[model samples]
Target: MTAGERTGEKKDQCQGTGDINFKDRIASSPCVFTIGVAGDSGSGKTTFTQSIRDIFGEDLVTTITLDDYHLYDREERKVRQITPLHPEANRLDQLEHDLVELKEGHTIEKPVYNHATGRFDPPIRFSPGKILILEGLHTLFTPTLREHLDFTLFVEPDPEVKIEWKIRRDINKRGYTREQVMAELGPREEDYQRFIAPQQQYADVVVRVRFSKYGRERGTQDKVYQVSLSQNKITQSIEDVDLSIDLFSLLSLSDRNFLIEFSHEQRNTERSGELIFDGELSARMVERLEQSIEDQTQVRPISVFHNRGHVTATEVVQLILAWRIIHQRVFLERCHHLDQIQG
Candidate 1:
């Protein structure tokens, strides 16, 4: 299917009453829940955020596309020999300013970047609400910007895999030719390494989607691999393998069964293990890692999310469970022993 068609299908599947409960929870939270999903183009950032919007409804959730903060138009960027993926290519200061405003509970006019024409579109006015999902290439890169968010996420699929997805997406949805995509990809790669990849260090969650082993063994190229990273002292390799296994195993189940189980259990569950069988290990490891890192650095770690767009309501519940596990673990780890003792 074409990219737009694929997106539409996912959207259709995502519509249900289950999201109402999720939205109600966000509504009751004291502070707005801000999530940033950063990754290369076509890494499913937009799709993921859209699913969240579908859950919360556009009225309760406002999404700010970091692509809108580009410092130059595509043609201008090319003329200046500037790689669009480079940090210099974006208006980092403006993004920081806007995020700060949002954190302070104010609304701001946001910029719009048009991929079709490769330029900034008209500025759009947005009001801050219960949850804001900020997404794009460099959403989590800057320290100032990262500080304003409640959750920071990085989505890095394998290079070859992402590129192929990009080719298919742009050609089918955006009406680009193969040669056009190839031209864009060449310069973008340099920018990605220098500007984009470094942001992964700041992510509370890193999701790496790889092709399934069965698919690989059968020479199928359509498999996806996802790995999540948090500020825990644990190494990336360990987290990647564990998160990948947990997510992939979850994805393997039929969506119908996943939803039925999630809806029946979410409201009553608190412990991480109650939500998913294998999530407990991932949660404990993350807690230990966060404790080690904070003890050494004296700075609290950020929370990140790997948003896979629209699965069954059960899948959404599982995703939220994983997030809460990571968030609670890190939060507890950051507190001083004195505070715990006093409590």
Candidate 2:
């Protein structure tokens, strides 16, 4: 019997008091929504989660990197000559245990993997919250891990775009030479296709940041693309924002548009909110929202576009809160439906 049924509270039980109700009981517990971002090494998975963290705020959400679950450090793996992309490179069983603890709303001491030092750092204890954003190379690869997630996201950029990002990120952040990065890329390509790419089929959403021909083509400019699969198979192109200054420049804008549309379509059928901001009230609200977001996220909202573009850190937090509200309503609706059926 599940925990709810074992509590012996008929009203609290999700399933009716019957012999065949055990399955229903397991299905109706308070759900933890998990979003997994899986992609190539430099396909912006970490960057994507940072944006999500900013929007959700640390109070309501927690993020865990799958890198922390690595079984061996870089030096050890190199000594063994085992590629990090392989399944054996990680402690999959421990990861499964961590997920179970999170599902139960219990705290866990998460291991810290330091890429620069090539080892595991001190264990950081954290309690799972309403939303959990997990990102890394093999986040979606394991079937057991995949089943626990409420939503799965795949970040796939064009190969050329990813290579450029990998080079820049490795050189600047990981202290890898351009030649070393290039050499590792070829060896990892097969592993990525074998293990990572296959997970995309199970994804509820696939986010692609692609370069499109628009105004003056200075270089490769990325436009955010979001595909939602829960309510409807809708594909949207988020407005093109400049990616020169920072990687997260366009993430909030894309997330805002997606959440607004998704919530409107699911909850209120009224199309009252404007998709694009233009007028004075909208502009003022944007300014106030930006200020609020900055107060929460501790990051300055950099200007990332031309033509009267203004997005603040506070607005991003508001967008995430709005998404949480919508998600909670959906959860409650499901609970009500289950209660009625049990009755």
Per-candidate Cα lDDT values, in order, are: 0.55, 0.54
Q: How does residue 222 of candidate 1 score in lDDT?
A: 22
RMSD to the native, candidate 2? 11.8
* Top-scoring candidate (lDDT): 1
Which residue pairs overlap in candidate 2's backbone?
289-315, 290-312, 292-314, 293-313, 293-314, 294-314
| Model 1 misplaced stretches (Cα beyond 4 Å) | 1-25, 28-30, 47-51, 216-322, 325-343
My TM-score estimates for the predictions, one after another, are: 0.62, 0.62
Model 1 TM: 0.62
What are the per-model numbers of colliding residue pairs?
Answer: 16, 6
Q: What are the per-residue Cα lDDT tens digits for candidate 2 across 25-73?
A: 3234355556666777788775545544554457656788788998999
lDDT of 1 at 6: 20
lDDT of 1 by residue, 6-57 (tens): 2233332222221123334446544565777889988867654453454346
lDDT over C-alpha atoms for residue 338 of model 2: 70
